[model samples]
Target: MNKSNIAILVLIGILFSSCTMKKETMPPNILFIAVDDLRTELGCYGNTVIKSPNIDQLAHDGVLFSNHFVNVPTCGASRHSLLTGMRPISKDYLRNDITELTLTNKQEQDAPETFIHHLKRNGYHTVGIGKISHSADGYIYGYNEAPSTKQELPNSWDELDFDYGKWKSGWNAFFGYANGENRQSLKRQVKPYEKGVVNDTGYVDGLTTKLAISKLNQLKKSSKPFFLGIGFFRPHLPFNAPKKYWDLYDRDSIPISPNPMIPEGVNLKSLHESGELNGYKLGEEKASLNHPVSEQYARTLRHAYYACVSYIDNQIGHILKELNKLGLDKNTIVVVWGDHGWHLGDQQMWGKHTIFENALKSPLIIKVPNKYKSKSVNSIIETVDIYPGLMELCNIKLPDSLDGKSFVSILEQKNMQTDNVAYSYYRDGISLRTNRYRLTKYYRKEEPTIELYDHNSDPFESKNISNDNKEIVEKLIPILEKGNKEIFY
Candidate 1:
């Protein structure tokens, strides 16, 4: 018990405290990756057939939200919901041209804009490549016309970039083929599936990966922490990829949809005639509730879709490798997300405009630096929650008017019970999904005003048990009404 011994112990304690404080004060960078029209059909999600090693590894290293949904099923509206952290308050917000007239007409002073803009204003160097907003290159342009000079999300990023390569523009690159012809130039006569003999560079997603890697290298020298958004367009229409990707899948082994028929007792108005898939003039067959697609065609289409998913997974693998190579993985919060899910001949539908579980359920994986432990959460979460969640994780100032509640606590606590209900809208129909049931109501005057499906009994939603389950309908109607009431006033 000497004075010298007491002085030495106090000095050691002070040094240890300083090291912990330095680690806590350092801000982390962000790498946000968006994939288009991807579903929960990966090896990580327990789909044994499809091969997705890289994405699966990410899930193994990060936390996966098992039941993640979008506020809107379509691409533009869904991304708007995520970026703005709000639901569709107006008709314009529900459509693909989310910024076309709304941004110009509706002016709010001192209002918080998209999350990217907020990040940029808060000392983060924001950079976007590919389709972060409604447009392909974060700029507005018609699908067939030449590219325009206007930015879709103005003042949101320090740089907006895209590498169109032989396609010349972002829109063209989205639909471009191996032979340098796009659907627009071909007048929409392209087939729904194509296997090219060229390498991965023959596609637009490959070029996107190259540009993102280059940006990472450049950002490494910058003094401030960065927020980089990278979007990949694949597993979408005209499913085209390299021959090597296609070779990875055996055509005969691809499986068709287990629940391919239209749900019993469901109104026909609730479904559509696979319009997006039929848009390709060279498509062999038409799909409808009256007549489903042939099994052979379905298998072929599934094979192509799986190949595209594998291709995009490879591109993701490349970008993640580049991040680790640049030594950014340890200090960056990496997120891999799909804007919305797609239907591979589910419910006799081929696109993503429905309010069904197949169209709304997508993949979500978040990896925090030095905190990854392969966690999985089954609580229902919406895509709008991403905005506030990122802000909270980065320790940035959160603004008012955010509709999403942050889920950072869910990452820290394994058994946390998050908001169990997720709401989605498509056209005039609104659907709400709870832990065990999905209740949908159409605003239009239809024969069946309410459609209810018990997820516990029918996970595939093979039948609409609305008529038989009156008790469940009564319990869920009030919840839906309250959500509807919020849309106005």
Candidate 2:
């Protein structure tokens, strides 16, 4: 062959090699949607009642984890575990203010504070909207106090923003009512639920949705892979939504928890007086462990919560549609996760500060381009695993300090070799959840410090057979204690 002909062939080969390399080297964009106070009671999780069509469709297009649990059940703590990939190593780590206390006003350094910071270090543009951290916005403020210029995550986001709109402050908007009045302004005199005659833009979530859609449009033109975190306010508190979303559900058909009474063998110390729900002074009635709310009132509160879920679902639909229209869905890794689960009259409780299954289980849906399709992973996974999982999914290098092991294999191969266990911490108790059992141990002076519930016969956790199941407790305590790095006792 002539030298000129060989040189031309070599150039063609080099061009082909680069074309292949481009496909492998281009990193995927991340669309992370974190909802507050959500649980496994959605249409995608086999709830025929809740009108969560958008989220259900997300499950249809990607992977849904039916057995996912959080390490902590509160908003700030659970998200801390999620963002940092660490379990409750210290009692102080379980506080909602852990992020603000540990990370605020810090200088930049090589060691990333959170996983989002890690992504930022790796040449990704991170944008945050709404309550990605403990605060409604990224700013620091008390519920009744003025806002400050401090960041909860000091080095995480490139642009941290929240559109409080007419409410004037992020905290006010979070606990807002329809008429621009909020719980703080009203001195907590307002009811815990509201149905307003406004469009989707009537609430802050609507504004957040608009902002997210606009961000997606702008992000499509960026040169670097973007990590966009869109956090929604509802289904969290005050149960406020446009009247249209509320009107979608029939009040009579709203289902309350089947196991509404206290479990058979548990002490009253394990439960509480629904302190969080009772904070709204004008609530129809307070929730208590001894005297549970009436069935009729329970359905009413549940109805309001369903409305908020539908409202948030619509907001998610808007952002997802924008992503697809901008062609970002083709290379974007989308995640729909709830910070933690709320108790809608489970065990006669109305909050998430419990070590039960209902409080710890939340919805987690992940969609990767051209990978798993319409899949459901029932093996137990925890909130701590999300950081490592995302790192592996985005082809980024995994950090050795993360507490979670990657479940990316479980995303593809349904029946891979693995241990299906999840651990949760609340109060003085440490709990473990397996495929068929839930074991909890409290470090206190109580007769029934150990609680065991077999999910096979009682998925609602209505009965505790710890005394009868001593052998099971003996077998699972070591596994549970392994996760309790800092023992309370």
Per residue, candidate 1 scores C-alpha lDDT tens digits across 102-206 of: 552344436656888888888889999998877888888788878887777766878988888999988898888988899899998989889988888889899
lDDT of 1 at 151: 79
Error of 2 at 104 (Å): 1.5
Evaluate all candidate structures by whole-model CA lDDT and list the values in order: 0.86, 0.90
Clashes of each: 0, 0
- Best-matching candidate per TM-score: 2
How well does candidate 2 score on lDDT at residue 404?
86
Q: What's the CA error at residue 300 for candidate 2, in Å?
A: 0.6
Error of 2 at 63 (Å): 0.4
Q: What is the lDDT of residue 276 in candidate 1?
A: 90
Off by over 4 Å in 1: 1-24, 104-109, 485-489
